[model samples]
Target: MVAAIASVASVAARRIRGGEGVATRGRVLLTLDPGALSHLARGRDVVLVTGTNGKTTTAHLLAAALGTLGPVAHNASGANMSDGAVAALATRRHAPRAVLEVDELHLARVADAVSPAVVVLLNLTRDQLDRGSEVAAVATSIRKSLRRHPRTLVVANRDDPVVVATVEGMPRVTWVAASAGWSGDASLCLRCGRQLVAKHEWSCPCGLSQPQADWELDGAAVRGAGVTTPLHLRLPGRFNLGNALAAMAAAHALGVPPGAAADAMADLESVAHRYATVRHGSHELHLLLAKNPAGWAETLPLLKDYPALLLVINAREADGRDTSWLWDVPFEQLPPRPTVASGDRAADVGLRLSYAAVGHQTVDDPLAGLELLPPGEVVAVANYTAFADLWRRLAVMSGR
Candidate 1:
């Protein structure tokens, strides 16, 4: 009765709060029934995608790929903790399959409960330093969880040393040669604690090395299991291409044909507006979310072509309180363009840029910063809460 009431109330709240009640629903369920998530997840084919970055997009892709087989329940709004999974599963109890994005630190708990048929580990990086665990600690947590759930098949990135180390000897692991765009986090060897050497493949003097991949991501295609399919996606960035490869490999493990899965993913334009563009006074404002340094490393290069750039930073609980990670970003690599920093921590962002010798303006208000950009095309990059703020502001501006 409590489960039913919570689900119904959550649906009602979603309508009133513009679809922001998923976490609330999950919280209510867990509060009233401690085992609500595991109970709701029973008898469902589940795939849990967890990592420091690309969890949202990879979960979206995996959900889309599985949709080709049957109805899939997914946390499309990016609420990725155990509570969020409970909300998604409870609301769609009849769905045969579920693709959930799990938080890095919560993967062990969620995986132990859900016992997902497949788990995709993207890459581990330094993020949310104020409250989150360090890279090695996060990897150790996942390693222990996978040992507990021996039946789960893991699809891991071979290029990322941390990811490779996490699923090293798992019997049913499928390694994908996904690009490790940021290697700063994996400089030290996980096995020998010695410095790793990265050339064609990352290796340690103690004999730890990148494993042979069952599925390889070639430029625009994924080749594996005697098939190659081109991923024609509306999402931008090479990191997304690697994400697609991971999704395809996991889908194949679930018995879905690679071609059909790729076809299903092509229509997905964006994941919670990661690369979504909104109209602003006769100009196009492209929005991208970059929370940590690794994400910024991949996102910065993609913005080289944009005529104007706006960066928003915030230190809310959702976005780790310590803004020191901003210094790790490769702002020096940013191309010459009209740039502006806006958000609660816009001053911090501006200071970092100043040290990088990139001239920029600081505006505490995001919408006001948008107004300052010259009309043509503006690329906006923001962290967690800042992105949500700008997304809401754009919706209100358009009277949505």
Candidate 2:
């Protein structure tokens, strides 16, 4: 009965897309089975990317790269849940492969229904406290899923100890190392259960025998697909480069030819609002959804050499009830102070920024906070809910 309903929903959704060019059948199915993605795949090349951060970006890269080789199915919109997976999968006809990004904690549910050719665990970080297990616990869940699928090749970030530790000795898995040491930090050593120390801007090693990786991404600009543009991404920071490389390696592992995969990344489109740059009068606003500590840390480089205001919003229960991790951020790096504080929980965001020497001007609503921002160059770091509320205002203000 479950299969029948899902197939029917997907068929009707496909028909609607032909005329309307928009599919809602997948949205409708979300109510029936949030974990229904597992059922839709059989004898198709499947690439699954699971992690706390950068899954959306990596998935988009993989989708773009795979499109050149053959038809590909991808949840590029970042919905990422079962319904979203069905929607993406339903749009294609006779596609050879599908690249899907699964939420870290939900890997077990999704993996149960679908078999994958390669499973790429990007990196496990502390995120969504109310909903997920600790990094180690979540890594364990992913391990169980990997253990269940014996043939699936595991592609991963060797720099991340948690994921590297999970499938260390697992055979038929390819590990890829990325040159993201400059801006990102993976604190714990997955091998010895000790804090892996980093020396002279190199690897975070416990000096123990760890598994070797298969591919490596080195340098600021990437060289693949016969293109070497340096990839000075419109999106700021170095950690994102790691996300880009993970997709490149995964797509290659799934057999998308290296040259074409790089072309897809170079000709990539923004994932709706993920790291989308919008211009106001004089200031440029980069919109991103930071939901956890690692998510928030990924954007720290955004504050480099900017005297503009900083806004941090923390309200969702999934974001964690305690915002004490704000102190953990190296806010001392930001020299100047912010202009105002705003969000559903403006007080909390203000307090965090305030401790870092930013002033507090409360606007109970995120939309109202936009009014407080002077009509010049501005930077805003909003939570998912706050971004949803103020996205319209941001579009209008930045002339999106």
Candidate 3:
């Protein structure tokens, strides 16, 4: 009865608001019945995906891979909190399998309620410093959750020291040699409080270190369980290759064939709007979302080949009220190009670019900001809310 009411209210709310309303609907349902989530998720084969980055993409890939086996329920819109989990499960109670994207901070609570069959822990990095927990705090929470839920199969990134520390000694762990390029926040050991030394492998003087990965990514192929399958990912970057590996491991843990997982991942064109190209007015804009310093570092390299780019930074609640992390990004790595800065924090981004000796012009409006860049395939990198706003605007313009 509660699930039926929550589902109806959620759908009605979305109809009235004319937005996706995934989060809002879940929030409304949770407000009415606090136990709605646990009740709805009961007796389901739930797969919980959590991390600082790649949660949405990895969840999408895992869910898609699992879809080959049977009907699956997943948080497809990237609403990853407790309410979001409830919304996904409540709406699709008939589905036999559930794939949920869980926030790093809320993983413990969500895991307790969902009792996930498999948990995928992607790379951790400093994200939303003002609002989110410290990287160590998040790692501690995940560690506790893993210890509490001993039966849950953990599909974790062996390359990430924090993830390794979290699931260390836990039984039924499937480790993947996922590549994590950003290490600024992982300089210190979370367990021993010692400086970590990294070369081919990472280790602390106090004895805690990265575990040997069971599934290793060699070039484009993933090797594990006496089998090797070529990972032909449609998503760009080594980070995405890592996400694919994590998904493959999670799928394998859930009895999905390696070949079928890889094939499903290859068919994925984009997660939400991370790499979608849209035509706005006369400019063809390629949209990319980079919410923090580490994300920006990974995204900046893609812009190197482009002639001109649009960089948007908003200090909205979703994007973190603190825009200070912009200085930590290595904007100096960017070559000489006509960069147009946009968003509520456009001036702050322009100042950071100035310190790095990268020339840029600031425009308050994102749509108008495109005027600064020359036409023909302009790349626009936007932080959280800026990216959301632009994505909505682009979608409306494209009549999608």
Candidate 4:
């Protein structure tokens, strides 16, 4: 009966707001039946994907791999909190398998409610500084949750010190050496309170160190469980390779064959807008979203050779009220190029670029900023809200 009502609400929401109503439908369902999430999720094999970054992409890969077994339901649009999870689960009650991308701080609550069969911990980094908890605090919360659910299998990233520390003593853990490019947030040890010694292998004075990974990424190939397969991903960057490895580990934990998982992941074109190219006003814009310093560090290297790029910065609540993290990003590493800054905090981004000695112009609108660049293929990077706005604008302009 609850499923019937929630289904009707989801349909109504889609009719009223189109694709934007996905989260709203979940809200309406939860409001009508507060306990609908657990009821809907019962007796299903749930894979909860959680971390500061790449959760959505990992969930997408896992869903595809698990699809080999049967019908699978997931939060494909990346709405990963309680409301979003409830919406994804309630809307697809007939599917036997469910994959969810859960936010870092909300992992404990969501895990408890769903009693997930597998929990994939990608990596932990400082993101949305003004709105989210500290890195150590989030790690602690995940540790407690893992301790409480001893029966759940954990697919953890060995490259991330914080992630390794969080799931260290869990009974069932599949460690994956998914390389983490950003190391600023993990310079210090999360467990021993001492500085960590870094190298190919990192260890602290307190004896805590990276665990031997059950699954290891060797270039584009992942080796594990007595088999190795090349992971050909359409997505760019080493970070995405790591996301694929994490997904492979989670897939294996759920009884999916390793070779099949790699083949399934290779077919993915994009995770929403991580690497999507769209046309707007006779110009092609490649969209990339970087929310914090760690994310920026990983994303900026991809634009080193571009002749010009558009960068948008916003301080909206979704983007965190604090914009201080912008200074931490190494914008100077890029070859000298004309960068057009946009969004609510356009001046702030311009100021940071100036300090880095990178020449740039400030424009308040994203589209106008893109127009300032010479006509051709261009790259546009933005924070949370700014990225959403740019995506919507591009879609409308292209009649998508």
lDDT of 3 by residue, 1-400 (tens): 7857686767657763222487778888888888888888888889999988888889989988999998888888888898788889877878888999998888999998878889999878888778657888888888988888899999989888888877888998988988777888888888888899998899999888888889988888989767999889888877888888889988888888899999988988888788888888788888888888877777877887777799888998767798888988999898887789889998999899889999888888988888878888889999878888889888887898
- By lDDT rank, best first, the candidates go 1, 4, 3, 2
Ranking by TM-score: 4, 1, 3, 2
Q: After superposition, how far is residue 99 of candidate 3 from its true place, in Å?
A: 1.1
Off by over 4 Å in 3: 16-20
Task: For residues 187-262, write the lDDT of model 4, one tens digit per residue.
Answer: 9999988899998799899888989989998877889988888889888888888888888888888889989998
Model 2 lDDT per residue over 1-400, tens place: 4566667776767655221222367766656766555555766888888887788888887888788887898876665666566666665635779988887776876677778888888887776555647777887888888889888888877766677777766777776675433233356665567666556332344564334656555476554434453443434557667777777778877776666667678766466475666775555665666666676676777656554553646567545666665666665566565466676667776677677775557777654555566666566777665665466666766665
TM-score of each: 0.97, 0.82, 0.96, 0.97
Error of 2 at 102 (Å): 0.9
**Candidate 4: lDDT over CA atoms?**
0.86
What's the C-alpha lDDT at position 66 in model 2? 80
CA lDDT, every model vs. true structure? 0.88, 0.67, 0.85, 0.86
lDDT of 1: 0.88
Candidate 2: deviation at residue 393, Å? 5.2
Give the winner by lDDT: 1 or 3.
1
**Candidate 4 clash figure, as a count:** 0
TM-score of 2: 0.82
Error of 4 at 304 (Å): 2.2
lDDT of 3 at 7: 63
